[model samples]
Target chain A: MTSAPELVAIVPAGGAGTRLWPLSRRSRPKFLLDLLGTGRTLLQDTADRLAPLTGPDGLLVVTGTAHAAAVADQLPQLAGDGAANLLTEPSPRDSMAAIGLAAAVVEHRHGPTVVGSFAADHVVPEPGGFHDAVRTAVEAARAGYVTTIGIAATGPSTAFGYVRRGAPLEGVPGAYAVASFVEKPDEDTARGYLATGEYSWNAGMFVARTDVLLGHLTRHQPTLEAGLREIAAAWDTPAREEVLARVWPGLTKIAIDHAIAEPVAAEGGVAVVPGAFSWDDVGDWDALGGLLPADEAGAHTLAAATSAGDNGAARPTTAGPLLAIDSPDAVIASDGGAVAVLGLPGVVVVRTGDAVLVVHRDHAQRVKAVVDALAAGGRPDLL
Target chain B: MTSAPELVAIVPAGGAGTRLWPLSRRSRPKFLLDLLGTGRTLLQDTADRLAPLTGPDGLLVVTGTAHAAAVADQLPQLAGDGAANLLTEPSPRDSMAAIGLAAAVVEHRHGPTVVGSFAADHVVPEPGGFHDAVRTAVEAARAGYVTTIGIAATGPSTAFGYVRRGAPLEGVPGAYAVASFVEKPDEDTARGYLATGEYSWNAGMFVARTDVLLGHLTRHQPTLEAGLREIAAAWDTPAREEVLARVWPGLTKIAIDHAIAEPVAAEGGVAVVPGAFSWDDVGDWDALGGLLPADEAGAHTLAAATSAGDNGAARPTTAGPLLAIDSPDAVIASDGGAVAVLGLPGVVVVRTGDAVLVVHRDHAQRVKAVVDALAAGGRPDLL
Candidate 1:
C-alpha cells in the first residue's frame, strides 16, 4: 500500500485538572489552559513539540466528548487537510480504552505505521532533543518491537511510575529493552529507584507498529481485542456509537502501562528510549511555577495581573482586573471571581462561578475527594 | 436649660475597611460589618452598648459620605424620633475632624453635658462592666475632667497607643490622673509598658464635658479649633454645607489621640478609669475569627452557604473553604475572594478587591507599607 505512512502521532487530551481547580474545571481541562500566557495552550505546545518529528505529515488527537471542541479550536493550524485526526470518546473509561480507541482508528486509517502516544498536558522544553528521542523510539518500533520513552530520573519523586531498563537494543545505543514496569512507588522505593541508574520515569510516551500493538492487546487482553474488533467491524454502521457506548463503560479502568506495557515486559521483549528533553507532567501548582519567571521571594502568581507592586494594595495593577492575589507559593486561578492567597503557602485556590476550592497542594491528588463530595451531594451540576 | 441633657454619645463611625481590604471595602466599613453574625453590626452593637448608659435619646453618628445611608439603615432603632443625628463628612479628613465636628454639634445642641465618645468599630463584650465604667467616666467628666477609659494592657501589642496612669484625682478613687500619652510603642517599649502596672491601652473611649473637649482643642490646636468653629457655625445656616465643604478639605489630617489626647495628657488633669471589658477594633481578617464563632479547627468563614461536614465531598473533610485560611498561628482575611494559607506561622493575609497584602500577624501594623507601595505606584484608587 505504497509503504505505510512513516510516522503516526496520537494525542489524548482529556484529563480534567482537578488539582488545578478554579482555573481548570470540567468545562476547561488542563490541556486547554494558557498557563504562563505564552500565547499557546499546553495542547498546542504539545502539538508543536511533536510537529518536527512527524514532519508536517501525520498527527491525530483523541479526546473526551467534553474536550473535543476545545482541542479542535486551539490547534487551527492542523485543520483544513487530514493532517490532524480528531476522535471523541463515547464515555469516561480510563486511558486503556482511550488508547485502544485511538490505536484502532490509527490502524484502520494509517495501516501498519509507527504510532507515538503523547499526553497533551505535558511540556518538553527542548523540542529538538525530544524529537530525536521520538525518532529513536520510531526506529525501535520499525524493528518489530513496541517501544516506550522513559524520562531520565531527575529526583526521587514518588509521584510518577518507574520504568526499569533491561538489555540494550541492537541498533539503538540509548534504547533499552524495558526490564519491568512499576507503579508509583513509596518514597524510599523511589529513592532506591533513583539511586539505581537502571530506572527512569514512565513518561507515558509510547511508540509501536500498529500491528504489534494490536497483537499485544489480543494476546494479553482478549476482552479489549474483542471490543476493538467489534468497534472496527461496525465502523460505518449505525450501531457504531452504541456499541462503543456499551463496550467502553465495561472495560477495565486501567492505564496503558498496567494493561499493555507491564504485561509485554513480563514476556521480556519491550524496548525503552531515554528522552533527551526536560519533561514534566505540569502535575501541580509547584510544577507550574518551575516554568515561570519568579522574583527574589520565590513567589510565582498565576494571576499575571499580580506582581510585587500590586501585592501591597491587594489589588491587581494589570488592566485584566486581578481576580487573585499574594498567595505566596500557592497556585490561584480565577475565571469569574477574584481569588487572593493571603499568607497561604503551598495551597491551591480555585474560584469558579458557583464553587470555590481551597486545598493543600500535596493533598491535590485527593481533590477527587471534592469530586466524590460533589457527586454524593447530588450536585452533578457542579461536577 | 433644665441642667442640660445629661449626656451626648459621639459615635465615630467614619473609617473605610481599607486596611482590612476586600471584605472591608468602601461600602462595608468595619463598623457596618456583621463580623460575629450576632445579626447586629459593629456600629449597631456600639450604639446598643451605649443605649443603657444614655437613657433613650443621647446618640449621634459621624460617618463618611459614602456610608451614611448604610449607617442609618443599620441603626434605625437609635433614630426612632429624629433623623439619627447622622452627620456626614464630605470626605475623609481623619479622626480629628470627625471627633471635632461631633464635639461642636454636641456643644451647640446640648450645651455642656458629658459627651461619651465611643468608637463604632470596637467590641466591648461585657455590657454590665462597660456601663459601670461609663458611669464612672461620666462622673469624672461632670467634674470638668476629660475622662478616658484605659484598658488593662493584655500583651505587648504595638498596634495601639499607650497611656501612663499617673496619681489619683482627689474625689475619683479608682481613677488615675494622666501622666503622658505615648505613641504606638516599639515592641521593646510595648513589652516594658505591659510589664509595668502604670500603663494601659489608649482604648479611644473617652468621656468629656462638651466644653472641656472644645476648650482643650482650642488651646492645643488653634487652627483645628478655628476650623471646628467654622464647621459648627455653618450648621443650621444656608452657608453651613458650603463652609464645611470649603473648610473640611483643608483641615489637618490627624488622629484625635495625636492632636488632642497626647497634648492634654502632657498638660495633666485628664483622668483614667480602669475599664474592664473585652475590647477589640476588629481590625483585620485575623481579628474576625476571634469575633465570630470559630469551627472546631478555630477556622472562620464568611460564605452565603456553609456546611462543614466530615462526609461532604464538595467541601473539605479536614479543612473547609476558607475565605482567608490563616494557619495554626497565622491570621488572614478577605473581602470574599478565595484566600488560602499554607506553611506560614503567625502571618496575616489580607485580600482587598484592589490589592493583596501578606504580612506576619505581629507585623500587621505595617499594612501601611502596602498602602505606601500603592501610593508610590500612583494608584490612589486602591489607597
Candidate 2:
C-alpha cells in the first residue's frame, strides 16, 4: 500500500440542503448535522473517513464565513494546525472557486502535492472501499490525470450524474481513462447506463495534483484561477481578508465539473476510479430514510441509533423520544420534543425548536419549494 | 313561538376524546378546547347556544371533579346561582349517571320543569334552526314524552348512530315518534339510512321534563336512578359530599342512549325533533377539519381561526405562524412554535408543547390507537 503523505483532503462544506429543512437550516447546514444518528456530524464523518489517507493535520475544510466558527467547533482537532486547515470563504462563489482556492492554497503550502476534494455532506458506509478508491485515484493523480472516484451505480438512480469509463489506465490497475461526464439522467437513461456496466455515479469527488487542478482551471476558467491564486498568495499572511474581499466576489460562479473535469476529460486528461462503497448524498428525507434501518414497526427514527457515541456510549442530541403507531416507512426527525406519527405511511415529520416540517416521502423533493416560500414570505429567520 | 320559561339546559360535559389525542387530554378534554377556532370552547359554545332559551340561572353544567374548576372558569356566569347550577361528579359513572344526577337535581330545585341535556362538545352552526327544533322538542317533552333533537343527516356518515323517525306526533307539529335508535352503521347501512329520509343522526340531545326523564330512568335503570335521587336529596345541603362520596362509585356505568333512548324508543315512548341546523360531534381530526375554513392555499389552520373572540376580532392563541407549501387539504394545529407542512395533501399535523402528532386524513380516526399505544407504552404524560 502506498502512503501518500503529501496528499491533503480538501472538503468544501456548503449547500443549504433545503430538502432536509427544519433539520438542516440556514444557520445549521447538513454538513454540520449528524443526520445518520451516528453520533458524528457529516463533516466529522467525512474528516474521519479521510483521516486514514491524509493522516493527522492533512485535511482542509473550506466553508462559508457564516459557518466558519461552527465548522471549527465541530472539528476541534484543526486547532492543533493553527486552524490553517479550516478555510473560510468571504462568500459563496460556487464550487470552482471554492475548490480552486483550496487547491491553490495547498499547492502554495506543500509545493505540488496531491489534493483530493470531497463533499462534507455525503455518507460512505464502508470506508475500506473508499480508502482503496482514494488510493487508486491518488496514484492516477500522481501520474498527472485529474482523477475522480466514481461510485458504483447501485440502482437506476436519476439523482446523480454519471461518468462513462473509457479504456483502462496503462500503469494504474484500478483506474480507467474517463470517456465523458454526463449530467443527471432520466430513469430510462440511467437504467441504460447501468446496463452498460461501464458508467458510475459521479459523487463529485476529485483527486488531483494541486498544480494539475489549478492548471486545468487556468486553461478553462482563467479569471477564476487568477482570483484563486491571488487569494491563496495572501491566505497565510495578514493580507488574507483584504485580497479575498477584493477578488472573491468577481470570480466566476461554476461547479468544478463544468470548469475543470468536463473540459479536462474532453482533452483526455481525466480518469475514473470505481468505488464499491455504499454511498449517498442524503439529498432529501426520502434518501435519508433509505439509509436508516427501520424498527419493528417499520418506522425509521433518526434518533435512537444516533444518540450513541463513537465508543457506543450514550451521547444524546436534543431529539426527544419518537412514537410511531401503525405508520410503516415513516421518517421522523426531531430536536424539539417527542414526535408521534400515527397511520401515515411513508410520512416525514421533522421538528426543530422553532419550526416543524411535515411532508410525505413522495413529496420530499418539494421541501425546497417550502424553503423558497418561506424566503418569499419574509421568514428569513426560518430559512 | 312560546317561550318555555320553566325550561333549563343541562350540559353533561365528559369524554376524553382520545381520537383527538395530543390536543384533547384526560385533564383537558375536547369540551374545554376552542377546537373550531371559534373564541368559545365547545362547552362555552354549548352554553352560549342554550343561554337564550334557558334564563341566566337556568343552565346547569355537570362535569367530572377534575374539570369543575376549568368549567367554572370558562362559564363564570354560572357562578351567579351560588355555583348551585354547576354539578361536579365525584367520578365518571358514564353519561346515564351524569345526566341523571343533573336531571334529578334540576327536578329537586325546580319541580317538573323542562330540562334539555346537550353534550358540551358538539357544534351547531345555525342556532336559529336549533332554537326551532328545541321549541318543538320542548312541546313534545311537555306532553310527557322523552324528546331528542335528531340532526338532519347531512350524508351517509358511519361515525354517528341513526334515529329512525316514525309518524308525526299527534299535537307536536315538527316532532315525530322515534321508532328505534340504531348503533353506528356500516357504510352500506348508512347509505341505506340516508336513502330513507326518515332516518336522522342521533346527536344525543335529549329534552324532557326533569320528572319525566327521571321516570324513564327509574323504570329502566332503577338502582342507578335510586343512587342519583339519593345524591340529589343532599346535593344543595351540607351532606352533599358525604352522599356523593358514598353513592357515586356504585352507580351503573351506562350511556344515556342504551339506558334510556333505545329502550324508550322500543316502547314507543320516545320522540325526535328533526334539527335542521348544521351539527357535528367533531368526532376526529377529519371531522374537525371539515368545520374549519381553508386558507388561500387550501390548508385548514385550526389555531388561527380559534384565536379570535366571538366578535371576530383576532384573539391570537399561543400558536406561532403556520406555513403550508403545496399541501392542500392539510389541517395543522399547534400550540407550539411555527409549523410548516409541504406537499402532503389531506395530512393532519398537530403539535403541543410536549408532543406532536402527524397523521393522514384517511387515518384520522385511528389516532385513538396512538393514544392507547402511548398509555400502553407508559407515556401517560402524553395521554
Candidate 3:
C-alpha cells in the first residue's frame, strides 16, 4: 500500500487547573508542572507521545500568549526554525478557536493533511495502545470522516463524558460510526452506559483531515471559521499581527465538541476509534493520586524530579521528603519544606512558597471553590 | 490574715512539647510560642498572670540554656535587676531540679517566701478564680502545707492526672486536705473519678513556702535538695556557672510530684485549693482549640501577634490570613504564609517556616509519634 498521508498533531495547551491548586497556579499551570514526579512535564510527555505519530517536525502547539514561552521552553524539540509550530492566542477563545486556528494554519502551509488534536495536560500510560488507536482514527479521518479517539472505560466514572459507538466502518478496522455524545452522567447513568458495553469515555481526542475539519466548521460556525482562515492567510507574512488583532477578539468562544463533533455526529459524519490505553485528565488531587503508585503505607507523595520504582516505592531525588504516620491514602506534595501528616487518612496537603492547601480526598473537587473564594477576596497573588 | 505570706511564683518552663510539633520544637518549645494568638506567648501570659500575684520582682522563670535568649526577648520586663530571676538550666534534669533550684534561689534571696510553682505553658482564662485559688493556696502554704491548685474537672479526660480531695483544712477557707495524687488513668478510671465529685484535674500547680518545699525535698530526696542549695548559694556570684556545672548534672532527674507532692499528700501535709477557673495545660492542638473561642464557622486561627476579641473573632494585624471552607472546629496556625483548609472538619493545620503539620483533632496527641519518627529518621531540623 502507498504511504499513509502525513498527520500533524495540534495540542491545545490551556486551563488553569484550579482543582489542583497550591501545586498548579495561574502563573504555573498543570501543563508545565512535573506533577507526577516524572522528570518531564505533562506537555513534554504529550509531545513525546504524539511525536512518533506526527513525525519529528509535524507538530503544532496552540496556547495562550502568557503560556507560549513556557510551552516552548518545555518542548524544545518543537521549537525549531523560529518555533513556527508554536501558535499563541491573544486571549482564550476556548478549544474551537485554538484547534480551528491550528487546522487552518496547517492547511494553508502544508495542504490538506490529516491532523489530530490532543490536550497538553492528560496522562496516558502505555502508549502502544494509544498509537494503535490514533493510527486507526487517522485512517478513518483520511476517508473523509471527522474521527475521534474514545478512551476505554476503566470504570463507571461520572467525571468524564461518554461516546456511544455504532457499527464498525466498512473500510477502517477498529473504527465505528458515532451514535451519540453524552455529557458527564450521574452515577447510575454512567453505570448503565458502562454495562451496555457500547460506550467509551470521551477523552477529547479528535483527528481529521485539515480540510475536512475546516469545512465542517465553515458550514456550522461560519464567523469562527472565517476568522481562523483569515488569520491563517497572513500567518507567515508581516500582516499576521494586524489580522489576528482584529479577527481574534470577535471569534466565537465555543468548545470543539459543541462547534463540530455533536452537530456532525447527528448527521452521520463522526467516527470513533476505541483507545485501550489507561488515561486520566488529572482533574484533581484525587485523580492525580490514582495515577501514582502508593508507598508501603498506601500513601502517595508527588514530588518534583522523582519516580516510583517497579516495586512502587518512591525514589525521591529532592529534599522536602513527605513523612506520614498512620495516614494511609494521603496525597502530600510540597515544594517548600517537609510535610508531616499524622492520623489524617485520605487527606490532601499541598504546600508551595506562598500558600498551603489542606483538603480531604473526597473534597478535592471543591478546591476550585477555594480558588474562586480567593479570586473573590482579591487575592490574585495566590490564584 | 497574715497578708498571704508574700507569694513568689516559680515557673519551671521546660518540655520540648513534641505533641505540638512543627510549632513547638526542641530549640523553640511551646512555652515560647504565642499559641493562643493573644499577642503574648504562653510563657509571657504565665508571667503576666503571676506577676500580679508575685509583684514585679517576685516571679522567677527556670528554662533551659538554649531558650534563655528567646525567653528573655519575649518577657523583657523580667530581665531587670541583672536578669537574676530568669534562671537558665545547663540541661534538663526534670521537674524536681527545675522547681527545687528556683525555690532554693528564692529562699536564698528573699528568705522563706511562699513559692508557687506554675507551669509556664498552661492557660488560665478568667484569672479571677485562678487568683483567688492561688491566694488560698498561699494561705495553706503559710500554714505549713504543700498546697496545689486543682482545676475543676470538665470531662472524663484520660489525658491528665486526677487529684482526690479530703476534709477541708482547719483554718484555710476553700482549701482541702489532699487524699491522694493519681497518675493519668484509663478511660474507665477517669470517668469514675469524674463521677465521684471528690476528684479534680491535677494541673501540676504546687505552692509552698521555700523553706517548707526545700524541707520536703530534703526529707524525700536529700541529695537533690543539697545540690540545689549549693547552686543557690552561688546564684548571685560569679561562681554560679561553676557551681551549676559541678552540681546540676548530678541533681535527681525526677518530677516534683513523685519526689514531694505524692508522698507529702500521703502524710496529710499536702492541701488542695479548688480552682474553678477555665484552665488547660495546652497539652496538644485539641486542648488549645478548646481554649480559644471559635469563629462563626466554628474554626480557630492563631497567628503571631494577633488576638481574638472578646467575641472570639480574630483581629489579624498582618498578611497571610488563614482561609477555610467547609472546615469546622479546625485549628490553623501559621507563621509562614496563607493557609487554606477545605472540607476537613476538626483538622489541625500548623505551618512554620521550615515545617508544616496536618493532623486531625482526634489524633492530636499522636503528633508526638510523628516527631519521634522524624527524630528516628535523622530529621532533627524538623524537630
DockQ of each: 0.23, 0.69, 0.78
> Which 10 successive residues of model 1 chain A have the least lDDT summed?
A305-314
lDDT of each: 0.70, 0.86, 0.86
| Top-scoring candidate (DockQ) | 3
Evaluated at residue A25, the lDDT of candidate 2 is 80
Q: Which tens-of-lDDT digit does each residue in B276-361 have in candidate 1?
A: 87688777655665665555444554431111123211122222244323246544444444444444445555444444455555
Q: Output the TM-score of candidate 3.
A: 0.94
RMSD of 1: 6.2
Scored by lDDT, model 2 comes in at 0.86
Model 3 bad stretches (over 4 Å): A1-5, A305-317, B1-5, B305-319
**What clash count does candidate 2 reach?**
3
Q: After best superposition, candidate 1 residue B71: deviation in angstroms?
A: 2.9
lDDT over C-alpha atoms for residue A135 of model 3? 95
Comparison by lDDT, 1 against 2, better one: 2
TM-score of chain A of each: 0.84, 0.94, 0.94
Give the Å shift of residue A118 in candidate 2: 0.5
Alpha-carbon DockQ of candidate 3: 0.78
Model 3: per-residue Cα lDDT over A93-117, one tens digit each: 9999999999998888888889999
